[model samples]
Target: MSSGGFHVHGPHDHAVEHAAQGHGHGDDHAASHGSEGGGSSMSKIAMFTAIVATVGAIFAYMGGATQANAGLLKNDAAIKKTEASNQWNYFQSKSTKQSLAELARDLAPEDRKAAYQAKVDRYESEKNEIKVAAEKLEADSHKFDRQSEEQMHQHHRWAQATTALQVAIALAAIALLTKKKWLEYGMYGVAGIGIAVGALATLHI
Candidate 1:
């Protein structure tokens, strides 16, 4: 029952959102100084931050979505497992009936023997059917569990990508404030790393 809204649920998601918003206007103060080259640099960094922020937002949304999917799928797994248990219980009951019928067949008088043997045969057939159903349910449960685990892994990748993007945004903000060329380089490097991580997430690596 996951919906379309991308609410910031994680602490890291909040941080990325805040960083994204703050950096969009970060160059304003730097621009007021009116150094032409510096102004251009500040503007470019601001734009970079904006783009990274957009990517981070996407990553955050994906993280939330995958997390929700993981939970839902895990619930499905649990439900299936419970159903499998019930089937097993049913199988056990049928087994008990079969045992009782077998005993009756052995102990019954000659005239009644055919009736008890027929009951025993019917119970055995019913037990086989229940066993097949129980095994199928157990297999289904395992499949759901595996799918849930994969979704959780994807969620972690998205979170990591978002975090990296947030760091890049932070660097852009600092570089904008200080007008340091090395910090700008650092910002670019971190931004590249963030995008690379996002690619990994996209590939589900």
Candidate 2:
């Protein structure tokens, strides 16, 4: 029937084709593995970005609080210094007036006595004014100190909060990188502790 012995694709050839098709499924599995690897990389980057932002926010808050606290402290010191200066001025003026009155009393004639009395009256008036000014200064200084102290306490709280936030962000980042469930929960727990501390401090203040 055939001109010579020759090979032809028949049922056996079809079986070989089926084997090739089954082997090709490996390529699909490999592609799926590649896709999963890419997804992992993307997820890692997202986690990193979130962690960095949280930490950055904490640092920013800390910086602001530091500046506020320093300014308040400086203000308190300045007010105290000014109050001291006012007190010194008042004391000096009173002492000078007293010395002058004593001198006038010691060396006075009848006509000069009237003039000396007038001088004493003027000095007394000036002394009263000085006393009033000193009292006002003292009051203002105390007010300034109280306000500054409050501001300092507020800033301190802000700093503490920022520090706590930073710690939480760092822990979260580590947990995500490591894919550890315990670490993730631990981060939240630590953050809660910080909040409690802040609350207590606020209550005390």
Q: Which residue runs does candidate 1 get wrong by more than 4 Å?
A: 1-34
Residue pairs with backbone atoms closer than 3 Å in model 1 (clashes): none
| Per-model TM-score versus the true fold | 0.82, 0.62
| TM-score for predicted model 1 compared with the true structure | 0.82
Model 1 clashing-pair count? 0
Kindly list the per-residue Cα lDDT of model 2 for residues 139-191, writing each as its tens digit: 67777766667666666665676677667777777876786767667777767
Model 2 clashes, total count: 0
lDDT of all the models against the reference? 0.89, 0.69
lDDT (10s digit) by residue, model 1, range 1-205: 2358754367787899899878866766566666878778988998999999998999999999999999999999999999999999999998898889888889999999999999988988988898999999999999999999999999998998898889889988899888889989998888788788878878888
**Clash number for every model?**
0, 0
lDDT of 1 at 127: 86
